[model samples]
Target chain A: MAFASALKCRECGREYPTDPLNVCEFCFGPLEVAYDYEAISRAISRERIQNGPLTMWRYQDLLPVDGDHAVDLQTGFTPLMKAPNLGRLLGLDHLYIKNDAVNPTNSFKDRVVSVASTKALEYEFKTLACASTGNLAGSVAAHAARAGMNAYIFIPADLERGKVVGAAIYGPTLVAINGSYDDVNRLCSELADTYPWAFVNINMRPYYAEGSKTLGYEVAEQLGWQAPAHCIVPSASGSMFTKIWKGLKEFEDLELIPKVHTHMHMTQAAGCAPIAEAYEAGVTRVRPVKPNSIAKSLAIGNPADGYYSLKTIQESDGDATIVPEDEVVAGIQMLAENEGIFTETAGGVVISGLKRLVERGAIKRDEVTVAYITGNGLKTLEAVEDTVRSVTIDPTTSSFEEQVLNA
Target chain B: MGVTVRIPAPLRRVTNDQDRVEVDAENLADMVDAMEEQFPGIKERLIDETGSLRHFVNIYVNGEDVQFLQGLETAIKASDEVSIVPAVAGG
Candidate 1:
């Protein structure tokens, strides 16, 4: 059942009908997808949700779209594994990893793109488009292909080669702007105003943002209907971070989770850690940065939801921190080595930030923690290209034994 | 009460196609008043009737967001450059 009632501004109390609108016309605040909780409680139950499809649509009551179509690549409902190995290594008793790299487009961006494209169809937009740092571009293109709509993706010219190829392979018109992700986004904003295309994170952002709620819902459900003590998520535009918090609150409000006290930590590359910087300084506003991190995907200098993300973290009693580039690479290696989960640079930020917190005792040893891995490692081979190397030896048992033992 | 206002491309008409304009104001609120004095309708684009900065419009003083410093009460130094940039999104 579709329970989304209207799109409401997050800042001001004004509301608008459920339309392809992202901002409040009056105060120009970001719009959020609002649902009638009374209707949702009557429409859905724990058993009903568990008995539904394994995809993200299982929480259709929480999302904006109907379950029949518009867009669905079987995204979400990803593996929520108990990382006993990583936990032992980090000296934490209970730790889990929300590995979203297994999505169809190989990142959590698929979750947002799916709902955005579907909402776009509802709005009768002929084209799906976005200005992305990296991951969203590929997801938008892939979903557009599946929905049989024209896709136009704009991205920074110097993004990872794999990500560029990833979007281009999906048959989208990829435009590479000659500047930072901020520059690309500025151009896309202008284009969004002029063109009739549904810029997913712009025109359809209220719905696009709702899809990330499924992550929080899935985590609690997978944990047998209880929220974790700590959760670390990578932040760029900070939309995903804020939505995940709303998702957990919605679950508790709907009685899916008895109560939620999850402390939401935010991770960022130090090169582009505006939100983290604000958080550490005990400030409310985020000062923009010129991004210069290997984690290009999470390198939005001026994150749109930066202030709100900081608010969520602070209100949840969570800490926000920045990871150096070297630590980011170490993080990717640590996760792969300990948990066998290869993740992109954003995941690197999360994993590394998690490690830093654990090391500093910010996250206690006994806390039930969850680290979100948002993208695949294949998208960022350049990050580990220098640190990870291969020693080629002759295809002989003697050479194999000697080299293997020596190393 | 003198400060430089950096306008973005879209709102260039507020400054007569000039990217940067010198405005006389002691704080952001005064600056908004000074701007509206020159350009009739551009102030609405920057702030709402309730006098809060527009969510889409970002005002930075010396590279720091005004909401962090003191909102409209943030002190405006003669050397400080105030830039009005729109919020960028997507990924």
Candidate 2:
């Protein structure tokens, strides 16, 4: 039931046949999966979708691969929490938190890697590879192991030790480049040219990125097949923000959701906010920065999808905001205190930007708003440990009592 | 027309890590051509073999994507700025 039709270039409107390719040969634009939407729309309905599995595979009809051999590790269908407490604290009335921090690898990247690996298996690729920051490295390694593919992942050497161990434990050939994530990505792009491996973010990216659309689908469905008034998403390469908007539009095209007004706001760490910097100055071009923030996961100084992401925000009449590093840590702690979501630094950027949006009177209090929390806090505990309070206690019963009853 | 072009971090290898470069051109395409003349090997880094801008790279003129405005044909004035940004795939 996979309704893939062709691979279309995002920059230029040229179309190519289905293949493990991500760029247009003619225009060099990024390629995306085109589908037989009319056929899919005729077959899938709200009832059909609701009756399906609780995971992202529920929309398998719209996805790229077929057969039961999906590289599924229970990736999607995460909770869409109604954050009245969080909303109240942020001075908003209707706020929803899409908590993807609980995924298998504690990041929403599990969703993309799961699909990419599955498609690679379908393509019979013997190797799985990607140029990652931190989260995708772990997710790709885990999925490649499950799919019986030889996984070779590359990341910046200074990545958090926790993330390094998290990926290494999965038994992948992890390469550490002593430079920025962009440097690692450049090397991988060169490697992809020579190696016969299925580089997830390079060749298999068209399908991999499609997995993010499920997040948008789930949000709309969870809200009764209606788009929210606004959405604030953290951006790294800027793919997630654009894909979420695409997901909402696809739902509307299929008549599964009503035509609704949803502004897509983008959030970034101030230390690495090239996209936000571009947007605030009313420019469409992003100026890459050397990422120097604790929010390492969001420290993509040269976002691949920066232009399109900025385009999406502007087209939707939305805005992009950059939160300072201190506020990013505070945002994580605040979300945990208000709604019990232990989010990572990127999530902190999102929450802090959401607050900024509200304070600026950009997002109205009564409007339905959703803030995307993409990763878990545990992986980034080092970033906020100094800022967060720790409970100190003694082993002795008397000391424990004294500490417990401190007045 | 003279415009200041900002070089992205990833492409700094070709530009000698100079964050910004100044060039003279009447349009986006002319500006890019001027950049290639000023900084050798940069066009290859920014554009593919097919002479199209790479998917990972974007050029902006005065804060607007050249793609949405005649792409390489986008007009540029003396006071306008051109920026070359590549996608950073870190997080």
- Model 1 lDDT tens row, A1-407: 27888888888779898977676644557888788889989888899999989989888878888777749999999999999988999899999999999999999999999988998888788999999998999999999999999999999999999899999999999999998888777667657766889999888888898889889999999989899999999999998998889899989998888878899999998888989999989888677778899899998888999888988997789889899877898889889999999999999899989989898888988888999999999999988888877789989988988987666
Cα displacement (angstroms), candidate 1, residue B47, comes to 3.5
Clashes of 1: 0
Those runs of model 2 whose alpha carbons end farther than 4 Å from true positions after fitting are: A391-394, B1-91
Query: Which candidate achieves the best DockQ against the true structure?
Result: 1
Under CAPRI classification, how is model 2 graded?
Answer: incorrect
TM-score of 2: 0.84
Per-residue lDDT of model 2, residues A1-407, tens digit only: 26999999887788988888876544446888999998998898999999888898888887887726788888889999999998988888899999998889989998888878888987889999999889999999999888888999999999888889999999999999988786677667657766889888888888889889999999999998999999999998899999999999999999999895899999998888989999989887576777898888887767888889988997788889989878998899899999999998999999999999999999987999999999998888788777755558878888777877662
Clash count of each predicted structure: 0, 7
Model 1 agreement with the true structure over B1-91: per-residue lDDT tens digits = 4699877655765568877888888899999888889887778878876777865787878766675578889989788888776675549
